[model samples]
Target: MQTFATLRTPQTTGLPARSGAGMLLMWLGIVTFYRIWVLPRLGITLYVDEAQYWTWAQQLDWGYFSKPPVVAWLIAASTALFGDDLVAVKLSAILLYPATAWLLFVLGRQLFDTRVGLRSAVAFSLLPFVSGLGLFVSTDAPLLFFWALAILALVRATSMDRWRDWLLLGVALGLGVMSKYTMLAFGASALLYLLLSPQRRAQLGNPRLWAAIALAAVLVMPNVLWNWSHDFPTLRHTADITHVEGINDKGGNVGEFLLAQLASLGPGFALAFLAGLVVAWQQRRDGRMQLLVCFSLPLLAIVFLQALRSEANGNWAAPAFVTATVLAVVFLSRLKTRWWIVVIALNAGLMLTVYHVRDIYRIAGKPVPASLDILKRARAWDVLARQLRPIFAAHPDAMLLTENRTLMAHLLYELRDMHLQHAAWKPQAIPQDHYQLTTPLGPEDLGRSAILVTQSGSAGVIERFSSHQTLAHVSVIAGPKLRREVDVILLEGFRGYR
Candidate 1:
């Protein structure tokens, strides 16, 4: 095995670093312009998740029921500066991707050559997941950015054994955790790297490593405390989804998840990434290859196993791709440029299709089916809100109530100017979401009228009210290719929370 001193030595590559930096800047400028100026004007309504985060941003907290508070914090910061418009809600996502791309470029250049760095950044930017991320607000935006930063810091810390680098790695890990719980995977990979690498194993005894761990713990302490005070709802929610406790017969889920990952990464890039994984395994003796593999593979394996046991979303392994992008580019760079170019072209086409999906469907003279249109959530909210405005104006004293969290979020954001009281139904139970937890219609609301909106009229809800009447039956268009109508019923005269 190579000694630590030998492994720490940086390799000199003939690739022009200045040119690579210039290319990164150019890409950043293009992406920034499109995201900031062009995409927001395309008339895409905010998705339910984005609206939910915006609602959360209005009442900033240390933690939320479904995830930590960083995403909400980010949205809050952006909307504060830019106002609570669609562009403002999604600003963090737009801005963060360029920073993530820049980090990928720098990490690749540090590990390999300028060509690899440029390719890796481009590959990351062109990912199908990124296509969605660039226009939508979600936890993935900040999680991915910090994940890449953590990996880069990990490389520097392991290779240089520098105290400052280790401290920086801790800060990144802490912030990543704040962004999303999946960041624990990166933390696990970092631990495994320290334990497995013979050359850097001596760092185990270094106080700096322990200090880094302590620093991360300190940074996340507030969130942990918040969870404790809130009956550990965040932990419970995470476990409920991940443990698959009540789920059975997950036999096909793993296969479905793998396929979804292929689609999410873009098929061409997925194949290249898998190939790069094999090459990294074959070249494990190289310290840099080992570092990349350590950061990239463990999270994917964990999510794959989770899929086998239960269900995993395609984006569950998103952070894994941060390092995987560099790995794929490094391996693909050894091949003819034509191979990677074809992949880039395919991915670019997919991204363009996603961006102009409505236009494409309109041009084809076809109604995008709800099943095929992934962007259906970003539609219909505006229409629904407009229809509800008159009903809300008619019942000035009535509060708004919804059984669905998604509806509650959309309505909350859409009717924000009304200043009407709203709450999610949680009769005889604990809160399931931030809205329910924060806005409980208890004894004080008894005999108070409410405008109840739900997917379907519930007998239980009718029984609790003094008198109920159906106001309007609205059809919401959802999905892209094969559009579907979702019927929403508006009810009035809910007298209490019973």
Candidate 2:
């Protein structure tokens, strides 16, 4: 698509012809390959949260305690064909990464110059936080994709005033809600925008706008019902974590959140995001900038308020980052080429720094190391899983008990899915299936010959199981990104006639 950016006059075009759609497509493809083939097959192993989601996939629920089931369903669908290996388990997110880039491209082209559009895609593709989020099998991947789609659709609806476009916006928002409850913030923001902006408020009278809202409600109704049936446990769970419980302290304070955001978005880009906001305001004379402001402001306000309440900084307003990146592309393009090159260099430096730092902890040997000290970030459960496989294979009747989901999924894949002989294995028995060791177990549940898999971090809970013996001692790295405080350990216990 030859646009203003590809023309000979840089003043009107504002972007090099060399930085066209073809170049952007090539970058997208390379990123797709790296995420799908390079990262998953590298055997980074699942994080505890990832493992928990895997467990959810097995149960196939509409919603879970902490999030909706889209991620679980996605993982389950991918792993079913891929045979539950690391690559298969995480493949779905990798494939979706490029789609996210494409969405950002559309958003950029619509918002700014063609150069800005292509640069936005590249910026999104390379953002350390976005890249890291994309590789993992988490709700965020799907949430980001759906949110981008919603933004794209909303842009079209705002521009074209087409009923069909509004319908698409509703569907996108609905799916996003299904993906992550945080999307409710976006929904609320949209409504607030409509109510506050006189121009947008006019849409309230439009049947198509109402139809979009109705469509979104209808799509999310099933999960809402599911939560209702489950005592709205997810809402309760989120509330508990965010308010009732002190886990909020563990997530990050306001200062930490600000710092983390800065780290995730390099200093240069972060500054550019701020600058872009100013530029958008100047252009707000144009209704388009108002759209960006409307999309971004409410979410930022909510997150900021939540921060005051001790909400984890990351959770405050993650979706806002994409808008920030888009804004950055717009501002950076107007700067001298030398200055633009400096910004790109800064981005490359940040990525390389993260890559190298993550590489040191590659337990399976990195196809490409992110950095040194990666082992410090490695999770200890990886090694323990390796040792438990043979023991579980020998005693097929014996059940495995894990305190957390990550360890639980690791055992499931290692023992039941791979390595072990599966002649006629039925699903796991009760307590063995998927019990939360974070809670206590009674005496009636004791004295069973079970492989009690518990992590050192949470070993205090299982310390009282006197009837069992520690059969093996194993350890794995913490992770490339997280701190290595306590290595996760697995304890095996056998019931004895005392």
Candidate 3:
């Protein structure tokens, strides 16, 4: 027993140096299986944002009213492969997660040692953030992977002082921007970092950096033009959502922001990240990682201040987390083997706890009840889709009216494969049969009767429809979260008039 115990201790103690590569790969393989196969097979549907993006994919434009078109392009490509299946949409980015992990490995190896690289890769791969976002198609997935790649490229350029590295960085930065406008934070940071560092400042004189920026600009110019042509409404929409000049009733709580970081990264890894931040700040002379720290600190400060002002965006602190994880691996690699084991165990525990809480209801024969009434609408959407089809079929020329575009989008995605679809009558940001008839239907459009589909929450908007005759009412049943009775009204009789 003593011999067996002694043998096990050395293996455990030496794992970081001896088998770090194998351990990291094993962790990544688990993530691949779970994210790419397991959760998807359990019938997890796309969230509203996912559905909206899928709708965007159907439209295939350069820019969207709220976000860039890369996410839409990705969704379209995925759905084309698997016929609009939700799991298929998810697989689009599940494939990218590993690539990001590999880049994390490369970045860590380049910045520090092979062990740090492996540890960082393992931490990133197991991060609860990756696990959740990996399966959900969003702007963030590509944004994250591309951001890491850009950072890696920057790291390579700094270390090697190579023009190719600079070019690669520029290409990545552009792709990252194409993914999300928020990537501007990283771009600004990279430019600033290069300028501030004496060693790297010489490269600034090189045309490569400018060329990269130019390339990114060229790649992204179409979307920029689209946003410009559309009066930059997406910017205004984002401003409204962020409460930049509008209702700011909710202020940020430092305590809450701190807690959210813990939740997002998981308790175990969050501590390691925080530890790394403190180390980086204290050991400011470490030139090797000072560049990343410089890039990360301002972003972290902005995120912290924003959290204090209002509810911080969930992914707002993502870049900061990336820096913290890299630093943690570098610092932790110097610690004893037993300490590393404890860290790994703690991270494993955090992941298990989160999985048990969030994914349990799905497995235990208990349908997870949604909190908001709108989700109930999402829950019973297929039934509502069926109820809506015949109403549209009856009025061969009739238009469909909706108060909310999101609700309409949900309906559209659910019925995408079906033939007879009810068009939304609204001011569409995207080209679709979906229209808005909130203001009076135009004379030509009103020549044919319209079907109005409104949720219980927005049913008051029904007053606008007072001019149209109500032929029949279909009580579109919804689940608890939605507390919604989607009313699909037929207006063929046309008795009421303005």
Winning candidate number (lDDT): 1
Supply candidate 3's per-residue lDDT for 330.
60
Q: Which candidate's TM-score is highest?
A: 1
lDDT of 2 by residue, 1-498 (tens): 122232212325655544667788898888777666656434466766677677677778677767887898898899788877667777777777677878888777766656777878888777767666666777878887888888888767755787878989999889888998888777776776566557667777878887898999999998999878767767776776567454465553677667767766678888887787899878765555565666766677666656666666474477777677777877888897676677767876765555444444445567433354442322445665666667676666556655555455555654546533211111222222223322223344444445555545444534544544556555444444443222323333422222
Query: What TM-score goes with each of the models?
Result: 0.93, 0.81, 0.83
In model 2, the Cα lDDT at residue 165 comes to 84
How would you encode candidate 3's per-residue C-alpha lDDT over 191-295 as one tens digit per residue?
Answer: 677666576677677677688778888888888898798677566666765667743586666677777677667776667666777777786655555766766
Alpha-carbon local distance difference test for all models: 0.80, 0.65, 0.66
How big is the positional error of residue 169 in model 1, measured in Å on the Cα after superposition? 1.2
Runs with alpha carbons beyond 4 Å of true place in candidate 1: 1-15, 41-43, 244-252, 364-366, 369-371, 476-498
lDDT of 1 by residue, 1-498 (tens): 343445433434465789778978898788777767767645568887888898889889999989899999999999889888888889899989888999998887777666777888988888888877888889999999999998887777767778898899889989989999898888688777877776668777878888888998898999999999989988888877776565546453888889878887888888888998899889877777877888878988988888877788888998888887887787778788899999889988997777777778789998655565676657768777887888889888778887777888888888889977886778857677777777876667777777787776477776777777777776655444422233333444456653
Residue 403's lDDT in candidate 1: 77
Please report, as a residue range, the 10-residue window in candidate 3 with the lowest summed lDDT.
Answer: 1-10
Question: How well does model 1 score by local distance difference test?
Answer: 0.80
Backbone clashes in candidate 1 total 12
Give stretches of model 3 more than 4 Å off.
1-26, 41-43, 253-255, 342-380, 386-396, 419-444, 457-484, 492-498
